[model samples]
Target: MSYKEFLVQLSEASGVSGYEGEVSDVIKKAFKEIGHEVTSDNLGNLICFKKGKNPKGRKIMLAAHMDEVGLMVKDIDANGFIKFTTIGGVDQRTLLCQEVIVHGKEKVYGIIGVKPPHLTTPEERSKPLEIDNLLIDTGYDFEEINKLVEIGDVVTIKRQVYNLQNNHIAGKALDDRVGVAILYYSLQELNKLQHDVDVYFVATVQEEVGTRGATTSAFKIQPDIGIAIDVGFGKTPELNQFDTIEMGKGPAFTVGPNIHPGVFNHLKTTAKDHYIPYQVEVAANHSGTDAWPMQVSCSGVATGVISIPLRYMHTSVETVNLSDVEKSGKVLAHFIASLNDENMEELLCY
Candidate 1:
């Protein structure tokens, strides 16, 4: 399948953080299509492995979280209006006037509602409304709504995945699902290349919450090298000019303490040697991606991070360039193909 098709299937699915079953199915199906078997762990991580020429040589893992930031039903008011709590790091500003799908007994469409501005004082209009004041209007009152919806049910913004003027994709859940798409494309590309180290691809869960899924998966896999694929801040006028990466230029390769010097060097060299367009990013302390936990897994691991530049993260309209996703996967496949015992040892001795 094409990258857009793969990403759309994942982006449209209701796979909120800590509730990634739907996303799991999509990944499993894609892996099956590519002739790889997928397995899930107790905490809901989906794993796929492609052994290298020497299966026992070195092991490397690539991870991309499958969870998306969403909301959970917190309370059902007397009139059946729904009150909800933010699931991951949902911005309060984006919650108003949103179209959401309540995942209760079935998918129920609803819109976020609040006090009418005409009836409100000028002070209220001047301030951002708190989440506590937002209510979901599901067109059902009391008894009828209670039957179809309940407390604790998940809610996701209803959004349609679409393309932009320059092959850019805009939608919800692209935060890491696009990373997963990169994994899919990488595996497809690997089918054409020969490599010497075993590769493990993990679709981790709960990254939006605390990088929890990668924490456990890394501990279990204990690979010699690990790479986390995630999204970086896309350049916008609102952001500091030097802080965000340009959207269409290329994927950003992270560098700093959280990243092993060896792994970073390998990624950098691969991009340069193969002429894959890429940018450099710095993470002073922790990168806030799955790479953070993967670095400290078990007896410690050599880890690196590669990010696809994205805009409006944690909101309904996250955006990414399709070329960036394709190139990220392409560069990663080449990086993996370049691995061998001699080079790996040389990289790590630093």
Candidate 2:
């Protein structure tokens, strides 16, 4: 499937943190259609295996999370309003006036309601916003809403993927779903290449809550090399050059203690040899991605990270450049194509 179509199907589906069943089905179907041997782990991670010509050769793992940040219903007021709490890191300021799909006994549309400005006191206007003060108005009374909605139902942002000027697109859940799209495209590219290493492409779950899916998958795979595909902060007016990468420039890779030097250098060399545009990201500590867990998995796996530049992360209007995503996939495919026993020996030789 085309990247645009794949993104729409993924973004429209709601798979918040722990509740990733709906989106995992989409990923499993795509992998199966691509002729991969796909299976889900106990933690709900989607793992696809593609055997290489040399089954005994090095094992390479590629990970991209499938879960996104959202809210869960917490309480219901007598007036039929709903109170919700975040499932991940959520900025309360962005809650007001946002449309949400409440997943309950049935799908219900609701909006984050705010008090009218006409009635706001001067003190209220000066105070900071809080999620506790917000409520979701679904246009149903207590008795009516009680039958359809219940506590613990997931509430996801209701938005459609749309194109933006300058070859960009905006929508919800682009954070890691964009990574998932890259993995799909990379698999398509890898199918045409001859590589010596066995490849396992994993769509991890609950990454937003904790890197739980990656942890379990990495332990099970025990790969010789692991690469985490995720989204990094994109350039915005408020962000500094050191903190964000420009959208459409190509993929940015992490370089730090968390990243293996040999793997990092291999990726840089592959990009240069293939004439693929890429930027280097410096992380002093952990990269805050699946790379961290993959690095420490088992006896220790050589790990690297490739990230697409994304704007308005964790918001409903997260934006990314499609071309950049494609570039990342192609670069990954080339990197995989170059892996072999000889390179593996040198890469692990300290």
Q: How much does each candidate deviate from the true structure in C-alpha RMSD?
A: 0.9, 0.9
Query: What is the C-alpha lDDT profile of model 2 across 187-306, one tens digit per residue?
Result: 999999999899999999999988999999999999999999999999999999899998999999899999999999999999999999999888889898998899999899999999
lDDT of all the models against the reference?
A: 0.92, 0.91
TM-score of 1: 0.98
Q: Tens digit of lDDT per residue, candidate 1, span 1-350? A: 88779999999988999888777898999999879999888899999999899756689999999999999999999998999998889999988899999999989999998788899999999999999889999999899999999899999999999888898889999999999999999999999999999999999999999999999999989999999999999999989967899988899999989899988888888889988889999899989999999989988999999999999998889999999988899899999999998888888776
On a 0 to 1 TM-score scale, where does candidate 2 land against the true structure? 0.98
Stretches of candidate 1 exceeding 4 Å from the true structure: none
TM-scores for all candidates? 0.98, 0.98
Worst 10 residues of 2 by lDDT: 49-58
- Tell me model 1's lDDT, rounded to 2 decimals: 0.92
* Error of model 2, residue 180, in angstroms: 0.3
